[model samples]
Target: MASQEKIKLVLLACGSFNPITNMHLRMFELARDHLEDTGRYKVVKGIISPVGDGYKKKGLVEACHRLEMARLATESSEWITVDDWESQQPEWVETAKVVRHHHAEVLSSENNSNGDDVDTGKYRKRRKMEKKSPSCMNPKADRPHLNLLCGADVLESFGVPNLWKPEDIEEIVGRYGVTCITRCGSDAEKFINQSDVLYKHRKNISVVREWVTNEISATHVRRALRRGQSVRYLLPDSVVRYIQDHSLYSAESEQKNAGVILAPLQRYSKTE
Candidate 1:
Protein backbone atom coordinates (compact mmCIF):
# COMPACT_ATOMS: atom_id res chain seq x y z
CA MET A 1 0.00 0.00 0.00
CA ALA A 2 1.21 3.52 -0.70
CA SER A 3 1.95 5.84 2.19
CA GLN A 4 -0.75 8.33 2.98
CA GLU A 5 -0.12 11.97 2.11
CA LYS A 6 -0.39 14.37 5.02
CA ILE A 7 -1.91 17.82 4.95
CA LYS A 8 0.81 20.45 5.32
CA LEU A 9 -0.14 22.83 8.11
CA VAL A 10 1.31 25.74 10.01
CA LEU A 11 0.27 26.54 13.57
CA LEU A 12 -0.21 30.22 14.36
CA ALA A 13 -0.33 31.23 18.02
CA CYS A 14 -1.51 34.81 18.44
CA GLY A 15 -1.36 36.43 21.88
CA SER A 16 -0.09 39.37 23.87
CA PHE A 17 3.07 37.48 24.73
CA ASN A 18 3.80 40.23 27.26
CA PRO A 19 6.75 38.04 28.04
CA ILE A 20 7.00 34.72 26.28
CA THR A 21 7.22 31.90 28.81
CA ASN A 22 8.41 28.29 28.66
CA MET A 23 4.83 27.05 28.53
CA HIS A 24 4.15 29.28 25.54
CA LEU A 25 6.87 27.50 23.57
CA ARG A 26 5.74 24.12 24.84
CA MET A 27 2.26 24.56 23.45
CA PHE A 28 3.68 24.35 19.92
CA GLU A 29 5.43 21.07 20.65
CA LEU A 30 2.35 19.60 22.29
CA ALA A 31 0.14 20.60 19.38
CA ARG A 32 2.64 19.30 16.83
CA ASP A 33 2.97 15.97 18.62
CA HIS A 34 -0.77 15.51 18.80
CA LEU A 35 -1.35 16.44 15.16
CA GLU A 36 1.49 14.29 13.84
CA ASP A 37 0.35 11.37 15.99
CA THR A 38 -2.78 11.18 13.88
CA GLY A 39 -0.62 10.88 10.71
CA ARG A 40 -3.06 13.17 8.94
CA TYR A 41 -1.33 16.54 9.32
CA LYS A 42 2.27 17.66 9.02
CA VAL A 43 3.06 20.77 11.10
CA VAL A 44 5.81 22.36 9.08
CA LYS A 45 6.07 25.56 11.08
CA GLY A 46 4.91 27.37 14.20
CA ILE A 47 4.46 31.14 14.39
CA ILE A 48 4.08 33.39 17.44
CA SER A 49 2.16 36.57 16.66
CA PRO A 50 1.96 39.04 19.51
CA VAL A 51 -1.04 41.29 19.87
CA GLY A 52 -0.48 44.97 19.05
CA ASP A 53 -0.34 47.73 21.66
CA GLY A 54 -3.75 48.99 20.48
CA TYR A 55 -5.28 46.00 22.32
CA LYS A 56 -5.38 48.17 25.45
CA LYS A 57 -4.95 45.39 27.93
CA LYS A 58 -3.51 46.31 31.31
CA GLY A 59 0.09 45.25 32.00
CA LEU A 60 0.57 44.80 28.25
CA VAL A 61 4.00 46.12 27.30
CA GLU A 62 5.12 47.79 24.10
CA ALA A 63 4.82 45.76 20.91
CA CYS A 64 8.54 46.06 20.20
CA HIS A 65 9.43 44.47 23.51
CA ARG A 66 6.83 41.74 23.21
CA LEU A 67 7.91 40.91 19.64
CA GLU A 68 11.59 40.80 20.54
CA MET A 69 10.97 38.72 23.65
CA ALA A 70 8.99 36.23 21.60
CA ARG A 71 11.87 36.06 19.11
CA LEU A 72 14.36 35.48 21.90
CA ALA A 73 12.25 32.76 23.43
CA THR A 74 11.90 30.77 20.21
CA GLU A 75 15.47 31.28 18.99
CA SER A 76 16.53 27.70 19.71
CA SER A 77 13.49 26.11 18.10
CA GLU A 78 14.29 25.06 14.55
CA TRP A 79 10.78 25.43 13.16
CA ILE A 80 9.34 28.08 15.48
CA THR A 81 9.47 31.75 14.44
CA VAL A 82 7.97 35.05 15.58
CA ASP A 83 6.02 37.32 13.25
CA ASP A 84 5.74 41.02 14.01
CA TRP A 85 2.96 41.76 11.48
CA GLU A 86 0.18 41.66 14.05
CA SER A 87 2.13 43.64 16.61
CA GLN A 88 3.19 46.14 13.96
CA GLN A 89 -0.40 46.95 13.03
CA PRO A 90 -1.68 50.42 13.86
CA GLU A 91 -4.78 49.00 15.53
CA TRP A 92 -6.00 45.80 17.11
CA VAL A 93 -6.71 43.42 14.24
CA GLU A 94 -9.18 40.59 14.58
CA THR A 95 -7.89 37.06 14.94
CA ALA A 96 -9.64 35.90 11.80
CA LYS A 97 -7.97 38.63 9.75
CA VAL A 98 -4.62 37.63 11.15
CA VAL A 99 -5.28 34.00 10.20
CA ARG A 100 -6.30 34.98 6.68
CA HIS A 101 -3.22 37.12 6.19
CA HIS A 102 -0.88 34.35 7.29
CA HIS A 103 -2.60 31.75 5.15
CA ALA A 104 -1.99 33.96 2.14
CA GLU A 105 1.59 34.46 3.19
CA VAL A 106 2.19 30.71 3.41
CA LEU A 107 0.63 30.17 0.01
CA SER A 108 2.78 32.90 -1.46
CA SER A 109 5.91 31.38 0.04
CA GLU A 110 5.00 27.95 -1.21
CA ASN A 111 4.42 29.33 -4.69
CA ASN A 112 7.82 30.94 -4.75
CA SER A 113 9.52 27.81 -3.48
CA ASN A 114 7.74 25.61 -6.03
CA GLY A 115 9.24 27.56 -8.95
CA ASP A 116 5.90 29.05 -9.90
CA ASP A 117 7.58 32.42 -10.48
CA VAL A 118 10.93 31.26 -11.81
CA ASP A 119 12.58 34.23 -13.58
CA THR A 120 9.19 35.97 -13.95
CA GLY A 121 8.09 34.26 -17.19
CA LYS A 122 10.76 31.58 -17.55
CA TYR A 123 8.80 29.13 -15.35
CA ARG A 124 7.61 27.34 -18.50
CA LYS A 125 11.20 27.12 -19.80
CA ARG A 126 12.41 25.80 -16.47
CA ARG A 127 9.53 23.32 -16.36
CA LYS A 128 10.39 22.15 -19.86
CA MET A 129 14.05 21.71 -18.87
CA GLU A 130 13.01 19.64 -15.82
CA LYS A 131 10.08 17.85 -17.39
CA LYS A 132 11.52 14.40 -16.61
CA SER A 133 12.66 15.27 -13.08
CA PRO A 134 10.94 13.30 -10.33
CA SER A 135 11.37 16.28 -7.99
CA CYS A 136 9.05 18.40 -10.10
CA MET A 137 5.91 17.55 -8.19
CA ASN A 138 2.73 19.59 -8.18
CA PRO A 139 2.96 22.43 -5.72
CA LYS A 140 -0.70 22.04 -4.75
CA ALA A 141 0.12 18.62 -3.34
CA ASP A 142 2.20 20.34 -0.65
CA ARG A 143 0.25 23.57 -0.28
CA PRO A 144 0.54 24.73 3.30
CA HIS A 145 -2.53 25.14 5.51
CA LEU A 146 -2.54 27.67 8.36
CA ASN A 147 -4.45 26.96 11.55
CA LEU A 148 -5.04 29.02 14.68
CA LEU A 149 -3.36 27.55 17.75
CA CYS A 150 -4.82 28.49 21.12
CA GLY A 151 -5.69 27.31 24.58
CA ALA A 152 -9.19 26.13 25.49
CA ASP A 153 -9.77 29.47 27.18
CA VAL A 154 -9.78 31.12 23.77
CA LEU A 155 -12.28 28.58 22.49
CA GLU A 156 -14.50 29.49 25.44
CA SER A 157 -13.93 33.19 24.84
CA PHE A 158 -15.99 32.87 21.68
CA GLY A 159 -18.98 33.20 24.00
CA VAL A 160 -17.77 36.35 25.73
CA PRO A 161 -20.23 39.17 25.01
CA ASN A 162 -18.91 41.50 22.31
CA LEU A 163 -15.37 40.29 22.83
CA TRP A 164 -15.26 38.33 19.54
CA LYS A 165 -17.45 38.65 16.52
CA PRO A 166 -19.51 35.71 15.27
CA GLU A 167 -18.37 35.96 11.66
CA ASP A 168 -14.77 36.14 12.75
CA ILE A 169 -15.21 32.96 14.76
CA GLU A 170 -16.76 31.23 11.79
CA GLU A 171 -13.91 32.32 9.50
CA ILE A 172 -11.30 31.19 12.01
CA VAL A 173 -12.79 27.86 13.05
CA GLY A 174 -14.64 27.12 9.85
CA ARG A 175 -12.12 28.36 7.32
CA TYR A 176 -8.59 28.03 8.65
CA GLY A 177 -9.45 25.58 11.44
CA VAL A 178 -8.27 25.63 15.11
CA THR A 179 -5.99 23.48 17.22
CA CYS A 180 -7.01 24.18 20.82
CA ILE A 181 -4.70 22.88 23.55
CA THR A 182 -6.77 21.88 26.57
CA ARG A 183 -5.96 23.39 29.94
CA CYS A 184 -6.80 21.83 33.29
CA GLY A 185 -10.06 23.67 34.01
CA SER A 186 -11.06 24.66 30.50
CA ASP A 187 -13.84 22.43 29.13
CA ALA A 188 -13.11 22.68 25.41
CA GLU A 189 -15.78 20.14 24.52
CA LYS A 190 -18.42 21.90 26.58
CA PHE A 191 -17.64 25.21 24.94
CA ILE A 192 -17.80 23.66 21.47
CA ASN A 193 -21.16 22.09 22.22
CA GLN A 194 -22.50 25.37 23.60
CA SER A 195 -21.72 27.38 20.48
CA ASP A 196 -23.69 26.64 17.33
CA VAL A 197 -20.93 27.94 15.10
CA LEU A 198 -18.30 25.77 16.72
CA TYR A 199 -20.57 22.75 16.76
CA LYS A 200 -21.39 23.32 13.10
CA HIS A 201 -17.72 23.29 12.19
CA ARG A 202 -16.56 20.96 14.95
CA LYS A 203 -14.84 18.64 12.51
CA ASN A 204 -12.31 21.35 11.67
CA ILE A 205 -11.39 21.88 15.32
CA SER A 206 -8.86 19.57 16.95
CA VAL A 207 -8.97 19.38 20.75
CA VAL A 208 -5.50 18.44 21.95
CA ARG A 209 -5.32 17.53 25.62
CA GLU A 210 -2.03 18.44 27.28
CA TRP A 211 -1.28 15.54 29.62
CA VAL A 212 1.59 17.27 31.39
CA THR A 213 0.05 20.21 33.16
CA ASN A 214 2.08 23.38 32.74
CA GLU A 215 0.64 26.17 34.85
CA ILE A 216 3.19 28.74 33.80
CA SER A 217 1.22 31.95 33.42
CA ALA A 218 2.65 35.24 32.12
CA THR A 219 0.25 37.03 34.44
CA HIS A 220 1.86 35.38 37.44
CA VAL A 221 5.28 36.02 35.90
CA ARG A 222 4.43 39.69 35.75
CA ARG A 223 3.24 39.65 39.35
CA ALA A 224 6.48 37.98 40.42
CA LEU A 225 8.51 40.57 38.56
CA ARG A 226 6.47 43.37 40.08
CA ARG A 227 7.00 41.98 43.57
CA GLY A 228 10.72 41.42 42.96
CA GLN A 229 10.39 37.66 43.15
CA SER A 230 12.24 35.07 41.11
CA VAL A 231 10.74 33.99 37.75
CA ARG A 232 13.82 32.16 36.57
CA TYR A 233 12.35 28.77 35.67
CA LEU A 234 8.98 30.09 34.53
CA LEU A 235 10.45 31.99 31.53
CA PRO A 236 13.37 31.65 29.15
CA ASP A 237 16.68 32.90 30.54
CA SER A 238 17.13 35.28 27.59
CA VAL A 239 13.59 36.59 28.05
CA VAL A 240 14.24 37.12 31.76
CA ARG A 241 17.41 39.01 30.96
CA TYR A 242 15.57 41.11 28.40
CA ILE A 243 12.89 41.92 30.96
CA GLN A 244 15.46 42.85 33.58
CA ASP A 245 17.50 44.99 31.18
CA HIS A 246 14.38 46.83 30.04
CA SER A 247 12.77 46.98 33.51
CA LEU A 248 9.56 45.59 32.04
CA TYR A 249 6.70 44.42 34.26
CA SER A 250 8.33 46.00 37.29
CA ALA A 251 6.28 47.89 39.87
CA GLU A 252 7.51 51.15 38.35
CA SER A 253 6.43 50.06 34.87
CA GLU A 254 3.03 49.10 36.26
CA GLN A 255 2.73 52.48 37.97
CA LYS A 256 3.58 54.29 34.73
CA ASN A 257 0.65 52.59 33.00
CA ALA A 258 -1.68 52.68 35.98
CA GLY A 259 -4.39 54.45 34.02
CA VAL A 260 -4.45 51.77 31.30
CA ILE A 261 -7.97 50.38 31.27
CA LEU A 262 -7.95 46.62 31.46
CA ALA A 263 -9.75 45.16 28.54
CA PRO A 264 -11.71 41.93 28.73
CA LEU A 265 -8.75 40.23 27.08
CA GLN A 266 -6.68 38.71 29.84
CA ARG A 267 -2.94 39.07 29.41
CA TYR A 268 -0.82 35.91 29.29
CA SER A 269 -3.79 33.98 30.59
CA LYS A 270 -4.75 30.53 29.34
CA THR A 271 -6.62 32.24 26.49
CA GLU A 272 -3.36 33.65 25.16
Candidate 2:
Protein backbone atom coordinates (compact mmCIF):
# COMPACT_ATOMS: atom_id res chain seq x y z
CA MET A 1 0.00 0.00 0.00
CA ALA A 2 1.11 3.55 -0.66
CA SER A 3 2.54 4.80 2.61
CA GLN A 4 -0.24 7.10 3.69
CA GLU A 5 1.08 10.63 3.23
CA LYS A 6 2.36 12.11 6.46
CA ILE A 7 -0.24 14.65 7.45
CA LYS A 8 1.14 17.36 9.69
CA LEU A 9 0.02 20.96 9.18
CA VAL A 10 -2.77 21.58 6.71
CA LEU A 11 -2.17 24.72 4.72
CA LEU A 12 -5.21 24.94 2.50
CA ALA A 13 -4.09 26.70 -0.65
CA CYS A 14 -7.47 26.18 -2.17
CA GLY A 15 -8.03 27.28 -5.76
CA SER A 16 -9.65 26.30 -9.00
CA PHE A 17 -6.69 24.40 -10.38
CA ASN A 18 -8.43 24.80 -13.73
CA PRO A 19 -5.53 23.28 -15.60
CA ILE A 20 -2.90 23.22 -12.85
CA THR A 21 0.23 25.11 -13.80
CA ASN A 22 3.78 25.66 -12.62
CA MET A 23 2.76 28.89 -10.92
CA HIS A 24 0.72 26.66 -8.65
CA LEU A 25 3.94 24.82 -7.96
CA ARG A 26 5.67 28.11 -7.16
CA MET A 27 2.87 29.04 -4.78
CA PHE A 28 3.08 25.61 -3.18
CA GLU A 29 6.82 26.01 -2.94
CA LEU A 30 6.40 29.43 -1.40
CA ALA A 31 4.06 28.12 1.28
CA ARG A 32 6.16 25.04 2.04
CA ASP A 33 9.41 26.97 2.00
CA HIS A 34 7.99 29.63 4.28
CA LEU A 35 6.63 27.08 6.72
CA GLU A 36 9.84 25.06 6.63
CA ASP A 37 12.03 28.12 7.10
CA THR A 38 10.01 29.55 9.97
CA GLY A 39 8.91 26.22 11.44
CA ARG A 40 5.33 27.43 11.02
CA TYR A 41 3.82 24.21 9.64
CA LYS A 42 4.57 20.51 9.33
CA VAL A 43 2.90 19.40 6.10
CA VAL A 44 1.61 22.22 3.96
CA LYS A 45 -0.22 21.10 0.89
CA GLY A 46 -2.37 22.69 -1.80
CA ILE A 47 -5.95 21.62 -2.44
CA ILE A 48 -7.34 22.05 -5.95
CA SER A 49 -11.09 22.53 -6.25
CA PRO A 50 -12.62 22.22 -9.67
CA VAL A 51 -16.33 22.94 -9.67
CA GLY A 52 -18.18 19.68 -9.60
CA ASP A 53 -21.80 18.79 -10.46
CA GLY A 54 -23.69 21.58 -8.81
CA TYR A 55 -22.31 24.46 -10.84
CA LYS A 56 -21.79 25.33 -14.48
CA LYS A 57 -19.87 27.91 -16.42
CA LYS A 58 -20.85 29.10 -19.91
CA GLY A 59 -17.89 27.71 -21.83
CA LEU A 60 -16.45 25.47 -19.16
CA VAL A 61 -16.04 21.74 -19.49
CA GLU A 62 -17.16 19.01 -17.09
CA ALA A 63 -16.06 18.81 -13.47
CA CYS A 64 -14.39 15.47 -13.95
CA HIS A 65 -12.33 16.85 -16.82
CA ARG A 66 -11.07 19.75 -14.73
CA LEU A 67 -10.42 17.46 -11.81
CA GLU A 68 -8.47 15.09 -14.02
CA MET A 69 -6.43 17.94 -15.40
CA ALA A 70 -5.57 19.09 -11.90
CA ARG A 71 -4.63 15.60 -10.89
CA LEU A 72 -2.45 15.26 -13.94
CA ALA A 73 -0.60 18.42 -13.11
CA THR A 74 -0.04 17.47 -9.49
CA GLU A 75 0.96 13.85 -10.09
CA SER A 76 4.59 14.49 -9.20
CA SER A 77 4.14 16.71 -6.16
CA GLU A 78 3.31 14.94 -2.91
CA TRP A 79 2.58 18.28 -1.26
CA ILE A 80 -0.31 19.06 -3.60
CA THR A 81 -3.62 17.29 -4.08
CA VAL A 82 -6.84 17.75 -5.99
CA ASP A 83 -9.64 17.68 -3.42
CA ASP A 84 -13.05 16.98 -4.89
CA TRP A 85 -15.07 17.19 -1.70
CA GLU A 86 -15.99 20.79 -2.37
CA SER A 87 -16.07 20.36 -6.11
CA GLN A 88 -18.37 17.36 -5.96
CA GLN A 89 -20.67 18.77 -3.30
CA PRO A 90 -24.21 19.41 -4.51
CA GLU A 91 -24.20 22.77 -2.79
CA TRP A 92 -21.95 25.06 -0.79
CA VAL A 93 -23.79 24.09 2.41
CA GLU A 94 -21.18 21.41 3.04
CA THR A 95 -18.18 23.74 3.06
CA ALA A 96 -17.67 23.81 6.80
CA LYS A 97 -18.18 20.08 7.11
CA VAL A 98 -15.50 19.48 4.51
CA VAL A 99 -13.10 21.82 6.30
CA ARG A 100 -13.55 19.87 9.51
CA HIS A 101 -13.07 16.63 7.61
CA HIS A 102 -9.73 17.84 6.27
CA HIS A 103 -8.66 18.88 9.74
CA ALA A 104 -9.60 15.52 11.22
CA GLU A 105 -7.73 13.72 8.46
CA VAL A 106 -4.57 15.66 9.23
CA LEU A 107 -4.70 15.13 12.97
CA SER A 108 -5.69 11.48 12.75
CA SER A 109 -2.87 10.64 10.36
CA GLU A 110 -0.32 12.17 12.71
CA ASN A 111 -1.60 10.17 15.68
CA ASN A 112 -2.05 6.83 13.92
CA SER A 113 1.21 5.80 12.32
CA ASN A 114 0.64 2.64 10.26
CA GLY A 115 4.04 0.96 9.96
CA ASP A 116 7.78 0.67 10.52
CA ASP A 117 8.81 1.56 6.96
CA VAL A 118 9.82 5.17 7.42
CA ASP A 119 11.99 7.20 5.03
CA THR A 120 15.22 7.82 6.89
CA GLY A 121 15.58 11.22 5.21
CA LYS A 122 12.09 12.33 6.24
CA TYR A 123 12.85 10.91 9.68
CA ARG A 124 16.03 12.96 9.89
CA LYS A 125 14.24 16.13 8.82
CA ARG A 126 11.52 15.52 11.41
CA ARG A 127 14.17 14.91 14.07
CA LYS A 128 15.99 18.11 13.18
CA MET A 129 12.76 20.09 13.29
CA GLU A 130 11.86 18.59 16.67
CA LYS A 131 15.27 19.32 18.11
CA LYS A 132 15.53 22.89 16.90
CA SER A 133 11.99 24.08 17.37
CA PRO A 134 10.00 23.85 20.56
CA SER A 135 7.05 25.15 18.56
CA CYS A 136 7.17 22.04 16.34
CA MET A 137 5.53 19.62 18.77
CA ASN A 138 1.75 19.24 18.45
CA PRO A 139 2.27 21.88 15.79
CA LYS A 140 -1.40 22.66 15.63
CA ALA A 141 -1.95 23.11 19.38
CA ASP A 142 -0.66 26.52 20.41
CA ARG A 143 0.11 28.40 17.24
CA PRO A 144 -2.52 30.56 15.58
CA HIS A 145 -2.95 28.12 12.70
CA LEU A 146 -5.87 28.37 10.40
CA ASN A 147 -5.26 27.60 6.72
CA LEU A 148 -2.14 29.45 5.59
CA LEU A 149 -2.24 30.43 1.91
CA CYS A 150 -2.11 33.79 0.19
CA GLY A 151 -4.67 35.55 -2.02
CA ALA A 152 -4.65 38.75 -4.02
CA ASP A 153 -8.27 39.57 -4.79
CA VAL A 154 -10.85 39.35 -2.02
CA LEU A 155 -14.30 40.80 -2.42
CA GLU A 156 -16.83 41.02 0.38
CA SER A 157 -19.91 40.82 -1.79
CA PHE A 158 -18.55 37.76 -3.56
CA GLY A 159 -20.55 35.87 -0.99
CA VAL A 160 -23.95 35.98 -2.55
CA PRO A 161 -26.46 36.22 0.30
CA ASN A 162 -28.87 33.78 -1.30
CA LEU A 163 -26.19 31.24 -2.11
CA TRP A 164 -24.39 31.24 1.25
CA LYS A 165 -25.51 32.39 4.66
CA PRO A 166 -23.02 34.35 6.78
CA GLU A 167 -22.99 31.58 9.35
CA ASP A 168 -22.00 29.10 6.68
CA ILE A 169 -19.05 31.21 5.62
CA GLU A 170 -18.15 31.87 9.24
CA GLU A 171 -18.16 28.22 10.14
CA ILE A 172 -15.55 27.32 7.52
CA VAL A 173 -13.16 30.14 8.38
CA GLY A 174 -13.76 29.87 12.09
CA ARG A 175 -13.49 26.09 12.35
CA TYR A 176 -10.18 26.04 10.50
CA GLY A 177 -7.86 28.99 11.03
CA VAL A 178 -7.39 31.06 7.83
CA THR A 179 -4.02 32.67 7.24
CA CYS A 180 -4.87 35.09 4.45
CA ILE A 181 -2.47 36.21 1.77
CA THR A 182 -3.27 39.79 0.91
CA ARG A 183 -2.37 41.72 -2.21
CA CYS A 184 -3.41 45.40 -2.25
CA GLY A 185 -6.80 45.67 -3.97
CA SER A 186 -8.79 42.85 -2.29
CA ASP A 187 -11.30 44.90 -0.27
CA ALA A 188 -10.04 42.73 2.58
CA GLU A 189 -10.51 45.32 5.28
CA LYS A 190 -14.11 45.76 4.25
CA PHE A 191 -14.70 42.03 4.50
CA ILE A 192 -13.21 42.08 7.98
CA ASN A 193 -15.33 45.04 8.99
CA GLN A 194 -18.49 43.49 7.63
CA SER A 195 -17.67 40.02 8.94
CA ASP A 196 -17.89 41.10 12.52
CA VAL A 197 -19.09 37.71 13.65
CA LEU A 198 -16.13 35.67 12.34
CA TYR A 199 -13.39 38.28 12.58
CA LYS A 200 -14.22 39.72 15.96
CA HIS A 201 -14.54 36.33 17.62
CA ARG A 202 -11.19 34.97 16.43
CA LYS A 203 -8.04 35.87 18.35
CA ASN A 204 -6.57 37.90 15.51
CA ILE A 205 -6.83 37.53 11.77
CA SER A 206 -3.70 35.90 10.34
CA VAL A 207 -2.79 37.72 7.14
CA VAL A 208 0.48 38.33 5.38
CA ARG A 209 1.56 40.41 2.38
CA GLU A 210 4.38 38.72 0.59
CA TRP A 211 5.63 40.23 -2.66
CA VAL A 212 2.88 40.38 -5.24
CA THR A 213 4.48 38.35 -7.99
CA ASN A 214 2.97 38.12 -11.48
CA GLU A 215 -0.62 39.30 -11.62
CA ILE A 216 -1.16 37.14 -14.69
CA SER A 217 -4.00 34.84 -13.62
CA ALA A 218 -5.79 31.83 -15.09
CA THR A 219 -7.71 34.25 -17.27
CA HIS A 220 -4.53 35.49 -18.84
CA VAL A 221 -3.43 31.98 -19.54
CA ARG A 222 -6.67 31.21 -21.32
CA ARG A 223 -6.59 34.39 -23.31
CA ALA A 224 -3.08 33.75 -24.50
CA LEU A 225 -3.88 30.20 -25.48
CA ARG A 226 -7.05 31.23 -27.32
CA ARG A 227 -5.14 33.86 -29.26
CA GLY A 228 -2.46 31.30 -30.23
CA GLN A 229 -0.01 33.28 -28.13
CA SER A 230 2.47 31.91 -25.66
CA VAL A 231 1.36 31.51 -22.06
CA ARG A 232 4.55 29.64 -21.39
CA TYR A 233 6.50 30.38 -18.21
CA LEU A 234 3.57 32.42 -16.88
CA LEU A 235 1.83 29.19 -15.94
CA PRO A 236 3.45 25.76 -15.58
CA ASP A 237 3.91 23.53 -18.60
CA SER A 238 1.48 20.91 -17.29
CA VAL A 239 -1.36 23.41 -17.19
CA VAL A 240 -0.51 24.53 -20.68
CA ARG A 241 -0.56 20.96 -21.92
CA TYR A 242 -3.83 20.15 -20.23
CA ILE A 243 -5.44 23.30 -21.56
CA GLN A 244 -4.15 22.48 -25.02
CA ASP A 245 -5.15 18.82 -24.82
CA HIS A 246 -8.54 19.63 -23.40
CA SER A 247 -8.86 22.77 -25.51
CA LEU A 248 -9.80 25.02 -22.57
CA TYR A 249 -9.88 28.79 -22.57
CA SER A 250 -10.58 29.31 -26.26
CA ALA A 251 -11.67 32.73 -27.41
CA GLU A 252 -15.18 33.68 -26.31
CA SER A 253 -16.40 33.13 -29.88
CA GLU A 254 -14.51 29.88 -30.31
CA GLN A 255 -16.21 28.55 -27.19
CA LYS A 256 -19.47 28.22 -29.13
CA ASN A 257 -17.93 26.05 -31.84
CA ALA A 258 -15.68 24.13 -29.44
CA GLY A 259 -18.66 23.19 -27.26
CA VAL A 260 -17.38 23.92 -23.71
CA ILE A 261 -15.11 26.76 -22.70
CA LEU A 262 -14.39 25.40 -19.24
CA ALA A 263 -15.97 26.31 -15.90
CA PRO A 264 -16.34 30.04 -15.30
CA LEU A 265 -15.25 28.98 -11.89
CA GLN A 266 -14.45 31.85 -9.59
CA ARG A 267 -14.52 29.23 -6.88
CA TYR A 268 -14.16 31.33 -3.73
CA SER A 269 -12.63 29.21 -0.99
CA LYS A 270 -11.33 30.22 2.49
CA THR A 271 -7.93 30.77 0.95
CA GLU A 272 -6.66 30.76 -2.65
Candidate number of the best TM-score:
1
Residue 200 shift from truth in candidate 2, angstroms: 1.1
Q: For candidate 2, give the lDDT.
A: 0.54
Mark the regions of model 1 whose C-alpha exceeds 4 Å error after superposition: 1-4, 118-142, 255-272
- TM per prediction: 0.86, 0.67
| Model 1 score (lDDT) | 0.82
Question: lDDT tens string, model 1, 47-162?
Answer: 99999888887677899999989989988999999999989988788888898788767866877888686456565554454334212133234456778999998889889866
Cα misplacement distance, residue 35 of candidate 1 (Å):
0.2
lDDT of each: 0.82, 0.54
Candidate 2, pairs of clashing residues: 9-43, 22-236, 59-261, 59-262, 60-262, 60-263, 61-262, 146-177, 147-177, 150-181
Residue pairs in steric clash, candidate 1? none
Residue-wise lDDT of candidate 2 within 1-272, one digit each (tens)?
11132224566655555545665556666655655554444554566555554444344555676787778777887878877777777643234455555654554444345542344666456545633542223433432233635453532433543434466556555445555555556756567667676456343334544575645566566667778998878765776676778667666633542443222233433323
Stretches of candidate 2 exceeding 4 Å from the true structure: 1-7, 33-40, 89-94, 114-160, 187-190, 201-204, 252-272
Indicate which candidate wins on lDDT.
Answer: 1
